[model samples]
Each structure stands twice: as C-alpha cells, then as structure tokens.
Target: MFAVAAAAGQTVRNAAQRQLTQTLGTVGATHVRFLFGFPFAVVFLALVVAWTGTPPPRPPAGFWPWVASGALTQIVATALMLAAMGERSFLVVIAYTKTEPVQVALFGLVVLGDAVTLPMAAAILVATAGVVLMSLRPGQTASRPGETAGGGARPMLLGLGSAALFALSAVGYRGAIISLPTDFVTAASTTLCVALAIQSVLLSGWLALRDPPVLIAVLRAWRPSLLAGFMGALASQLWFLAFALTAAANVRTVALVEVLFAQGVSRFAFGQRSTARELLGIALIVAGVVLLLWVH
Candidate 1:
C-alpha cells in the first residue's frame, strides 16, 4: 500500500514538474524544485528524529563516498529529466526512464557481479531495440504539434544521460545501505536531504552566473515552483523510504508505473493527446520491465 501511494505521488510530482517545464527552462525549474524542497525535507527529517526519539545514525567509514556519488548522479539525473520535458513526447521520456532498469541490471552484473539469467538478457536486448525503434522519427505517421522527426535529439540525449546517472545513483545507494546500520533510515534521509540542498545551491549559483533571466522567470513563478517543490519533497520522502525498505530494482520497477500515471495526467490534466505509437511504446516498456523482474 505504501509502495502504491509512493508510485502515485511520483506521478503527481512528474505532472507538477511538467507544469514547471512550461514556465521555466528544465534546469532552472529543477533548481527551484530542489531549492524549495530542501527545507521541507530538512524539517521532515528532523520531525522523524524527534518522533522516534533517536538521533540519526552515523554511517560507516566509507558510506559518505557512496552517498556523495549517489547524490551527484541523482542531481544530474533530475536536471536531465527536466530538460527532456521539451522533447518529442512525455511518453518518450517515460519510455527512456523505463529503460533504466535494464541499464541498472547490466551495471549490476558488471560492477557488482550480480547474476543475470538468459531470459533477462533477452529482455534487455528486446527492450533496447524497442526504445531505439520508438526513438526513430516516424516516416508514416503525421507529425503532431511541437513534434518533428529528429528534433527531440537533445532532449533524448538528456533523458538517457539522466537514466545513466540514476543507475549509478542506485548502485551507490545500495552500497551505502550495506555498509551502514539497519536503523539508518534517518541517516539515509538526512544524507539525501543534504545532497539535494547542495545540488540546488550549485545549480542556482551556476544559473545565476550564466543565465540570470531564467532565474528571474523562476522568481516570478515562485508560487507554482513552491507547490512543485512541495510535491517533489513529498515524493522524494516516499521514494527514500521505499529505497530503505526494498532493493533498488523492486522500487524502481514499481515506480515505472509512473509512466502510465503520467499518461493519464497528460490526457486529463494537461489535455494533451497521446498517439498510438506512444501507447505502443508504453506497452513495450512495461513488457521489458516485467522481463527484467523475472531475472531478479
């Protein structure tokens, strides 16, 4: 039940982020989400400590390195995902995110020496092929508004880069958890809160130096940004809890349902039309994820 709620929250968060994308550029929008979200997370963590009557545990000697790596990767992933919002289809971005499970599995096999069954390998190949096929500009289908063949390359690249970073982050977090204590939820949450703060500050500083106009736009749209941040913080809290309770694969696989949830949001909330090709891509992604889970 908690997992389902977390999944739903994530979908809502994505919708909020999509709204932010229109008013602010991707990086700028993400910066606002994190900047506003950091304080909420800090308070949430503090509340958890108070309620539990325990101080957050100190992580093991090497946990900081893993936590740092995870944080950096997650920050990059967030930026890339926000950038991808302007691309061909939100469906495309979702499809690419679905690809992350396969990538993480591959990384696990290589880096962590995790076992990969033949069925899982086949599924990975099939899923990769499907993503490539879907990514190709359609020759037969008529182009939709704000979409054209090959126009979404930049966003696609950004999305894939985000997925890669997410995979790295997953691995790092897994390592950190193993090295840390079992009751380290507080520590994990606190670490992530700090990491998000750092990422937001760095992104804000850079944007301020390089693109002050975007920052100005963000300020003007502060209300929406703050709301988005609240949603993001809530979603992140659930995700962190899920990560602490389950393996990354299980959590991410369940989270992939966010794509379907996004589809609903696009249709109803955003009043956007989704094409058959996009629907087909969604099915393919779900199938791939199912296959990945079989191996797990």
Candidate 2:
C-alpha cells in the first residue's frame, strides 16, 4: 500500500518536474525538489513527532554518512532523470528508469544483506527486459544537437546511470533507517527530513555560488515548484515508510507501476504516444510485478 501510494505521488511529481525542467533547466529543477520540499519534510517530521511522541533523531556516529549517501546520490539521479524527461517521448524515458529494480536487488544484497532468492531474480529479469525493450526504440536518432555519434544510445546511458544511482540511494536510505534505534514511523520521518535538509543545504549553497541567476529563477518560480515539492515530499514519505517495512528490492520492483502511470500521462498530458512495443513492455512489467507479489 505504501509503495502504491508513493508510485502515484511520484508520477505526479515527475510530471510537474518535467514541466519545470523546460523553464528552470536541469539544475534549477533538481534544486526545486530539495529546496522547496525541505519545508514540507519538516512539517511531516513535526507531525510524526507529535503523533508518536518521539524525540528528534539523535544519531550516533554512523547515521550521517548513510543518510548523506542517500541524499547526494538522489540529487544526481534526479538531474539525470530530468535530462531524460527532456527527450521527445517521456514514456520511453520512464521505461528506462524502471530498470532500477534489478539494480536495487543487487545493492540491497551487498549493502543491507537482503537476500534474493532465485524466483525473485527471475521476476526482476522479466520486468527489466520489458523496460529494456521499450527503451530500445526502433530507428531512434539523436533528438538534440549536442548528442554524440551514438546519439540513439544517450537515453539508455542516462536512464541506466540514473537507475544504478537511484538503486544505491535506496539501499543507503534503507540502511540508515534500519540502523536507527527508533520505531519505523520516527525513523522513516526523521530520515526523510534530514536527508532533504542535507540535500537542500548542499544544493542551495552550490547554486548560490555558481549559478545565482538560476537560483533566483528557482525562487521566482515558486508556485509550480511548491506543487512539485509537496508531491515529492509526499512521495518520499510514503517510500520511506515502505522502506521501513521491507527490502528496497521489493519496494522498487512494485514501484515499476510508475511506468503504467507514466503511460497515461504521456498520452493525455504530454501529448506523447507510446509505440505498440512500449505497450508490450508495460504488460511485461505488470506480469513481473504480479509474479513478484505472488512469490513473496
């Protein structure tokens, strides 16, 4: 349930960010999620504390590095995501990032000692194959001027790189939450808030120093950024809750439903059409998700 809610919220957030990317550019758009979302994260944390009667998080020596790992990697992954959204068809772009489940399983096994059974691995592969097929559009060419000679490959590179980094971030976040000596509610809320705070500070400082104008632009574009930020925080909170409950691999594999959500928005909102192959890809992803749940 947490993963489903997060997927829905994230689909909305991604659409909002895709719009922001055109106006703010990639860096500014990425910063908007952290900067504007931090306040909401704080609010969520306050609510959690009030409801749960838990004190603010007091970490020992290790929590900072773990949370920081999640925070920093998320920023980079988001930038790559926005870059991919700039492509001609966002449906395919989204399909590419849906590859994260396989990578997340690997990261979780290594970092969090989460074991993957043979059946789980098979489910991951089935789902991953669907996205890979969608990402490999026939006769795809460089849609932008700055693309390399292997222009067709740029989206795949961006998407796969983004997937791998997002997988690592998932592992890092889950590890941070698990290491905390607190209930799942407090741990998830506190981690979400602190990670956003770290991300906001670092990104804000860098933009102020190197891209003041873009920072100003981001500030000026507050209305849309607010919407995006709220959805981003909502999604992160739900995702953290899910992470607090299960392995990152399970959370991410189910989150593949975002591709189906993306399909609806792509056709209706973005005026982008998915090829027949892409629809086949979405079907395969759904099959894999069902198999995973059944196996679990």
Q: Provide TM-scores for the models.
A: 0.75, 0.88
Clashing residue pairs, backbone N/CA/C < 3 A, model 1:
none
| RMSD, one per candidate, in order | 4.6, 3.0
Best by lDDT: 2
For residues 1-296, could you state the per-residue lDDT of candidate 1 as single tens digits?
A: 33456678767776677778877867777777678788888888898888777776666778788778877888778767766765545556655665676777766667655566777666665555555445554553314555455445566577778888898787777666556665656755676586677677777788899999998888788788777777778777777776666555555655665666767777898799878776775676568657765665
Provide the overall lDDT of each model, using Cα atoms, as 2-decimal numbers.
Answer: 0.69, 0.86
Best TM-score among the predictions, by candidate number: 2
**Candidate 2 error regions (>4 Å):** 79-96, 141-159, 270-274
lDDT of 1: 0.69
TM-score of 2: 0.88
Off by over 4 Å in 1: 1-3, 78-97, 112-137, 140-159, 182-184, 216-220, 270-296
Candidate 1: residue 33 lDDT (0-100): 69
Lowest lDDT block of 10, candidate 1: 134-143
Residue by residue across 1-296, what tens digits does model 2's lDDT show?
79989999998898789889999987899788888998999999999999989987697668888899998888889778767666554645566677899899999998889999998888888878876776565665555787543244676678778888999999999988988899998999999999999998999899999989999999999998999999999999999999999999989888877778878887898799888898898888888888888897
